[model samples]
Structures are given as structure tokens and as C-alpha cells.
Target: MNEFVYHPSGKYLFVATGQGRVEIFKMPELELVRTVAAHSGQSNCVALAVSPDGKRVAVGASDALCFIWSIHETICERNLGRLDYHVRAVAFTYDSQLIATGSEDHCIDIAYVNDGSRVHEIRLEGEVYSAAWHPQQLILALHPRVILVNETVSVYDYLATPVESDLRNKNAHIHCCAYMETFRNDSKYPN
Candidate 1:
């Protein structure tokens, strides 16, 4: 398996495999529930994401496509189609209305979850290694060489000015970033 993600409800676990399969397993006992042939050919699934509501999942594959599946039905509901490059990361907004995908093409694509409609796109300076949505805000945190927070998806560098000094000369390459749920209620880590 390349990637696996537990449902927000902790009832199910979704596993993405190199053989283009997405397997669903029950939690705790870890019993097999269902298997979905997510991709075709020799392409492998590299990333998996579950919606906040635990009703949907998004699978990213090396075939340059992202497939969204229903958690209850175990069926592919929507295909994100081919991107400019292979997908490296996938994330769903807190409301489960939008999905954010990062690719090796150095771009992040945001799309509507219900209809697979393109909402917005952001091109970064380097390949996007990871992406995460704020737990209580509309901001999106993207990791390339430096951590960037996209506020409202319109401004690319909304928080850049405040953290410019710390980011300078750091030359850090972040593989992934996640917002702590408890931090949302804390004042110290305001989003």
C-alpha cells in the first residue's frame, strides 16, 4: 500500500495501493470491507484523503488523476481528470465542500466536491509536497520549499510578510503539514 487514511469517524480506514486499488477496512478489528479498482494500467495511487464528514474520500494516482469515492457506497463518484503532473497530496476542506490537490507540476488545484468543478488554482515556486486546510478558516496551508498560507484562495502570500524574516535562508522543504484541531480553539495559534 502506498497510502492509507482513517475516516474522521474512526469507523473505516481507506488504503491506496500501488496496484491501482483502494481498499476499505473496518477499524479496530481491521476487517476488510470493500475494494475499489481506482485506476487503470500500471499507474499507482500515491495519496489518499478522507473528508471531514467521513462520507467521502479522494484518491490521487500517478496516472495524473484524482478519484473521489463515496464512503458508504464504496463507489467512484467523480474523477478529477488528468492534471499537468502526478498528484502528490490531497486534502478536503473542513466543510467537505471543496478538495485541494497538489501536484508535481508545482500547482495546487481546488475543486468543488459535489460536482468536480474547478474553483481555483495556485502555482507555487517549487513542487507542492503537501497541503492542508485550516480547521476553522478558509485558509489553505501549502508546503513547497517554505510554508505558505493561502487566505481565501485569492491571495497567495497573505501571511508571507509576517513570517518573511523566519522563512528567509531557512531553505526548508516540507513534506507535509497538518493543523492541530485543538489549536483551533487556542488563541496562541490563530488562523
Candidate 2:
């Protein structure tokens, strides 16, 4: 398995494998329940994310596509078409209405989860390694594969507009990002 995530319900574990398959396992027992082929040609499943609502799982593969799997049915729900290069990261919005996929193509494409229609496309300065949505809002933070000069994680508003100056982090390569809780709209920290 290349990447694995526990469902938000804590009842199942989703594992993405090098064989382009997603293995679903029952929690506590760790018993394998089912396996769904996520990609063709044995392309490595590089990234995986379970929606916060626990209804779906998104798997990104070296095939340059992202597949949304049904948690209840254990099936390939929908696929976000070819992304141009190996998909490196996948993330779901706070409400699970959208999914964001980051690829080596230097693009973060946000698509609606309901029908797999693209909502927005965010082009980055470098290859994106990770992406995370704000806990209570449509905001997203992306960590690109950085050179020393562009080490900061880029934050964007709901419209995919860059807002890096609003929330700045310096002096470290942000391998990943997450929100422990919701952020308040205030003078210093506005959501």
C-alpha cells in the first residue's frame, strides 16, 4: 500500500496500493473487506483522501487521474479525467462537496463531488505536494514542491484566488497542512 486513510466514521480504513487498487478494511479487526481497482496499467496509487463526511474516498494515481470511490458500495463512483501528469495529492473540502487534486503538472483542480464537474483550477509556481481545506470554510492551503526561494505554503480563498499574504508561513518546507479546528474571523485572523 502506498497511502492509507481511515474513514471519518472510524469504521473502515482505505488503502491505496501500487497495483492501482484501493483496499478497504474493517477497523479494529483490520480485516480486509474489499478491493476496488482504481486505475489501469498498475499505475501506482500515490495519494488518498477520505471525505470528511465519510461518504467517499478520493484516490490519486500515477496515471494522472483521480478516482472517487463509494464508501458504502465499494465501487468506483466517479473519476476526474486525466490531469496531465502524475497526481501527487488529493483533498476534500470541509463539506465534501468538492475535491481538489494536485499534480506534477503544477495545477490544483477543484471538482464538484456530486458529478465530477470542475469548479476551479489553481495553477501553482511548482509541483504541489499536498493540499488541505480549512475546517469550516472553502479555503484551501497548498504545499508545492518548493525551491528554497518559494518555501511558503500558498493559501487560497473559495474562489481559488491566491491569498498568500493573508496567512504566511516561512522557513520550512510544508510537507502537509491541517486545521485542528475552525478558524475565527477576526482582525488578525480572518477566515
Candidate 3:
């Protein structure tokens, strides 16, 4: 498997595989639930994300397409189809209203979850390695060489700020980043 993400409800685990498929497993015993043939041409599925609402899963593939599936039905709900290269990162907004797909083409495409209509496109300086949405906010954090926060989807601009002076100066490469859910200041570590 290339990547796996647990459902927000902890009931299911979704895994991306090199064989162009996604395997869904039930928690506890990890019983295999379903296997989805996700991509044509047998292109690998590289990344995936579960929506905060626990109703959807987005899987990114080397075929340059991201497939959004309904959690309950286990069916392809929509396809975010405009990306030009292998998609490496996928994220859903805090409210589950939007999704962001980052690819090797040096861009992040933001689209509406309901209709799969694209809302904005963010052109970055390099191939986007990872992306995450702030757990309680609209901000989006990106990586590899830059840290960008999207102020708002309506604005269509990113605050291109570096996380640290040393990282910026030394050209440190960040492969991934995530915003932990601390809804009530519960803990600093991931659950």
C-alpha cells in the first residue's frame, strides 16, 4: 500500500495501493470491507484523505485524477479531473465543502465537493509534496519548499510564508505536514 487513512469516525480505513486500487478495511479486526479498482491503465494510487465529516474519501492517482467516493455507498461520487500530472496530495476543507488536490505539475487545484466544480488554482514554485487544512479554520498548509496558507477560497491567493527562518534560508524540504485536531485543546499529539 502506498498510503492509508482512517475514517474520522474510526470505523473504516482506506488504503491506496500501487496496483491502482483502494482497499477498505473495517477497524478492530481490520476485516477487508471492499476493494475499489480506482484507476485505468493500472496507474498507482498514491495519496488519499478522509473528509472531516466522515462522509467522503478522496483518492489521488498517478493517472492524474482524483476520485471522490462516498463513505456509505463506496461509490465514486465525483472526479476532480483537471490535474496535469501525478497527484501526490489530497485534502478536504474543515467543513467538508471543498477539496484541494496537489500534483507534480506544480499546482494545487481547489474544487467544490458537491458538484466537482473547480473554484481556484494555485500555481506554486515546485511540485507540491503535501497539503493539509487547518482543523478548525480555512487555512491550507503546503510543503516541500514553501509553506502557504490560503486565506480564503474566495480570495484565490496564498500567504507565501516560510515556517521558519532557518528552513527558508537553508532550503529545507518538507515532505509532508498535518494539522492535528485539538478541538478543545485536548493534546498536542495526533490521536
Candidate 4:
């Protein structure tokens, strides 16, 4: 398996394979629910994301495309289409209204989940490897290589302004990141 993620409702597990296949498994029992042939050829599917409501899923492949599927049916309802380079990561906002994708083209694209209309595109200095959304805010965490050298985690707001940057781990490459929900209700972390 290339990547896998559980549904927010804890009822399903989505698995993406290196051969461009996506399989959904039922929770607890782990029964094979459905399978999707996401990409053509032998492209690797490196990213998979389930929407907060557990009604949708996004799959990112080396074909430079992101496909959105409905949990109710085994069909791709929308496609973010082809990009400049292969997609490395994908994420959905907490409200399930937006989908974010990071690509080897050193760019991040934010699009409406319902219509696939791009809302914003953020260009970075290096290739974006991963992206994550804050639990309760519009903040986005991006794991990108700075100037094709340093692995950095950049925190940005909805407007695409860098609010903070952490370069503590010089030797480690952060492949993925997520915000803890423990501080979601705290006043110190404002949306």
C-alpha cells in the first residue's frame, strides 16, 4: 500500500496502492468494501484523504491528478484534473468544504470540494511533500523542501501568509503532520 487513511466517522478505511488502485475496507471487521481503479498505467498513488463528514474521499496519484469520490458510490464524481507535476499529498478541511493538494511542482492548490473550483494556489520555493489542516482554524501546515535543500514545515493562514516556520530538525524530513485537537477549544489558538 502506498498510503491509507481512516474515515472521520471511524467506519471505513481507504487504502491507496502503488499500482494505482484504491480500496475501501469496512471498519472493525475490516471487510473489503469497494475498489477503485484510480489511475491509468502503473502510476503510484501516494496520497489519500477522507473528508471530515466521512462522505467523500480524495486520491492523489503520480499522474499529476487528484480524483474525488463519493463514499456512497464507487465512482469518481470530480477530478481536480492534471497539474504541473505529480501530487505528493492531499487533505480536506475540517468542515469538508475544501480540498488541499501539494505537488512536485512546488505548489499547493486549494479547491472547493463540492465543485472542484480552485480557490487558491500557493507557490513555494521547493517541492511540497505533504499538507495538513488545523483542527479548527483555516491554517495549513505544509512540508516542503526550502530551496531544494532544507526540509521545512511552513505554517500559513487562509490568506497564504506565512505565520510561522520551524526548522528545528535539520536532518529529519517530515513526510506528514497534523494538529492536535486538545487545543481546539483553547483561546490561545485562535482561528
Q: List the global CA lDDT of all models.
A: 0.75, 0.76, 0.77, 0.75
User: Can you tell me which runs of candidate 2 are displaced by over 4 Å?
Assistant: 148-191
Q: lDDT tens string, model 2, 97-143?
A: 87889988867887778888666577665687788877877767776
Ranking by lDDT: 3, 2, 4, 1
Ranking by TM-score: 2, 4, 3, 1
Backbone clashes in each candidate structure, one number apiece?
0, 0, 0, 0
| Runs with alpha carbons beyond 4 Å of true place in candidate 4 | 147-158, 161-191
**Angstrom error at residue 25, model 1:** 1.6
Which prediction has the highest lDDT against the true structure? Answer: 3
Indicate the residue-level lDDT of 82 in model 1: 45
Taking the tens digit of each residue's C-alpha lDDT, what string does model 1 give over 1-191?
88899999888888988878888899899999888888875889989999999888899999889999987787899989747778889999888987889888767777778988766666565577678888866677876543344322222453211123443324422222322112133355566
Q: How many pairs in model 1 have backbone atoms within 3 A of each other, for residues 3 or more apart or on separate chains, i.e. clashes?
A: 0
lDDT of 3: 0.77
The TM-scores of all predictions, comma-separated, are 0.74, 0.77, 0.75, 0.76
- Looking at model 2, the pairs that clash are none
| Preferred candidate (lDDT higher): 2 or 4 | 2
